[model samples]
Target: MMREVLTFRGKATAGTEFALGVAAAVVVLLLWEVVARLEFVAPQFLPPPSKVIAALWTMATTQHLLWHSLISSLRVWVAFLIAAAMAIPIGILMSSYRIVGAPLEPMIDFIRYLPVPALVPLSIIWFGVGEETKIFLLWLGTFFQLVLLVADDMRRVPHEYVEIAFTLGARPRQVMTDVALRSMGPNLVDNLRITLGWCWTYLVIAEIVAADSGLGFVIWSARRYVKTPEVMAGVVVIGLIGLITDQLLRALHRRMFRYL
Candidate 1:
């Protein structure tokens, strides 16, 4: 069983996969701890996981960690939902009709390539240092890329499906909504899952400029004070949150697309 698990491209049970993942994480953490204790890296710069965990506890108790986490999570979700809502329809239209896509695609392509951080100043000037600014930055980071992805997913829907729907007397709109969009459902969800991760990656950039009361702000504050443990703890929290959200989305995809 162990040999099979180690073999390239070999199948493994769910439990075996889970155990392997956990074992790998444990090994990495142990090595990190050893490196920290042996002073290979200064403890101030690379605190052991134990100290990081302790710092997490301290922040949770004294620094309104839950509140900050909630704030950050709320910002991410709100921006992501808005991006998804807008991107889906636009993406569908663009892919379903060349007239809609022709002029729009080039502009979207250009805007999406522009760095989000480079636009931070404009975002701050436009929205000010407030919730709107953070949300805008987060939304900006996600929307353009997601729009393209959504369009690509729609494109991947077989033209035969559209032809069959048309043969059945389905209207043009019906062919789009019922055939193309429905066919793209699983892939759309997967695209969203990937985009949500990108949103999280932009969180700190959104909050770092001029903000308060989010996980990013917490990390930035700790850094200014040279509290390495706190900084690491905050990063770990963001990573853990991202991991959990990703797993939830994966489970949802599996359940919803069981046929696939």
Candidate 2:
């Protein structure tokens, strides 16, 4: 039957994808193990994959490194959410109103070019040496980027949609709600994905300043004592968490914008 044939083909495709993923993982691990054992690079600087895994396990079990890393990741995500929430609305408003955007354009441009890490001193002064400062720094780094992206997305929405809405006797508010916002969905999701990656990079910088706990703090502490394994372990944790977050965002985008 055609149904049976289609089911078999679907299973075959899934199996092939799974096999490719497993094979890629195995190849990477094998290469890492060989290079580390052969001392192709200083093991201290480039720890073996096995050593990294062992170090990760030890830290996870004994020192709660995983917990610390999770806390840092949560802080980054929270800051990112706050930034997106504030930026998207302001961006929409600016895009929708030329007068507002024209006046603010130069200031926004200036701030966008300012390196966020350089603002750590001011952040520390404003927020003090607390979690607040770290979160604030992360927010600062992500907010401007998302604002510009969202504003651009709004500007690029098809003019025809707005005209059609207007022709239907829709008010400006209705046009924005039904046409402009709907059109901006895919681009907004794309910007969020890009912003999430930016947030990860900024989180490390944020954690470096005035942080008592976090993966970044762990890495910083390890470097002082020359605990390379611990430092590498922290790096691995950040990468893994970032990858997981990105994949989740991608899945959410697919589900929310299925029509796109």
Candidate 3:
């Protein structure tokens, strides 16, 4: 196993990979517990795993942790779905016609580079710090990036495939749908998976201001009172959720694109 892991470009079995990942996590947590016990860093600042777990239990039982998790998950999924719905078509349009892409690409490039957190004030003003504002922030963080990725995926579809379609008497629309979209299937899924992760990263920023619920709110509230254990627990919950979400997406990707 050591030799396999040491070998560059060597493929590990799925079970081996899963074992390695679990082992690494356990090792890190053990080290953290040891360090905290030794007071290398103040426990208040860096709570041990046991404290974090205890805090997590308290939150789940009394602080409505599950409710917060559900709300946060809903916000992320809703925004992500909306972003995907809009971005896929826009990206396809941009890639399908140079006339459509020429003007839009530069604007998307500019907007995507603009800091998401900096847009919080504008989002709040436009959407009134309601659920809309939170959703909009998550969407803003995802859409511009995903659209560009989708467009690039479309562009990467081989010209030979398009040429073949055309030679076979396929219409423009048919060529796009049959050739380009079909060819970029794996890449499109990969891009969506990546952009979904980005959406999660913006969750705290989305829920930072005017938020009374969700894991982000819990974390922020705990921080204000210096409740490090609760704060860490909230953060850990987010990390766990993200890890699960990512793994699910990876499973979907593998199941959908087995040939790749």
Candidate 4:
């Protein structure tokens, strides 16, 4: 009887948590609809959810939303891969060797503090307002931070584990790969997922730099014309895409790291 009661309570708690999120979203939307319907705020400034949905439908049907969204997503992935590829090896080296870590740590610390939006002017000057500029901006935003995260993950491996590998006739390289990298695999993946979310946070900054298409461009362009519904629609699309990709990454992380 006690076990049955506990089981029922557990399921009830789970159901309540899920329902809370849905209920909160519905309440917010209802409030928004009420404000817009009653003209509590200017219609041009805060369109109703219905208007945003209509704008989304129009963009999806007439404006090739899929194509631009694909481009933005591709740019994000490319930039994230570039950052991860460069950061992982350098981070591993930093964690493994004091000589490598000491000289570069200060520079990386300083660089990570610089705002990514502040780099747009330099990015434009260097990459000339093209796709490369956008990708580079995203890379710059993620790389330094990700390097620190990777190094931290590497450092979390037990020093005793590496010592055991060394005692068993493992070479330095073997200890790095077999002990350090192996132990850090799940953490490295989790860090990558975290940094990927960071990349999405910079999508608007990346896409607004003289961009002609993509969701960010849509938002920027609509703002100039005072198209509130379209602007909100574009913002919604970016959020949805980010949410979907983030969920996918979470699922992949769970599948890859069952221990987590």
Best by lDDT: 1
Per-residue error for 250 in candidate 1, Å, reads 1.0
Which of candidates 2 and 4 is the stronger one according to lDDT? 4
- Please, what is the TM-score per model? 0.97, 0.90, 0.95, 0.92
Clashing pairs in 1: none
User: What is each predicted model's overall lDDT from 0 to 1?
Assistant: 0.94, 0.87, 0.93, 0.89
Q: Could you tell me how far off, in angstroms, the CA of residue 59 lies in candidate 3 after the best superposition?
A: 0.8
- Look at candidate 1 and tell me the lDDT of residue 225: 90
Instruction: Put down candidate 2 lDDT per residue, 1-260, tens digits, no spaces.
Output: 33543684544456666777898999998998898899989877777888878888898999889779888988888999999999999898888899878887778889989998889999888989888998888898899888988999999999999999999999999999999999999889989898988988988888877787899888898889877888888898998988887899899999999996
Poorest lDDT segment (10 consecutive residues) of candidate 2: 1-10
**Residue pairs clashing, model 4:** none
Worst 10-residue lDDT window, candidate 1: 204-213
lDDT of 3 by residue, 1-260 (tens): 78887899988889899999999999999999999989999878988899999999999999899999999999999999999999999998898889999999999999999999999999888989789999999999999999999999999999999999999999998998888888999999989988988888898988888699998999999999999999999988998998898899999999998898
Clashes of each: 0, 0, 0, 0
Q: Which candidate wins on TM-score? A: 1
Candidate 4 clashes: the total is 0
Clashing pairs in 2: none
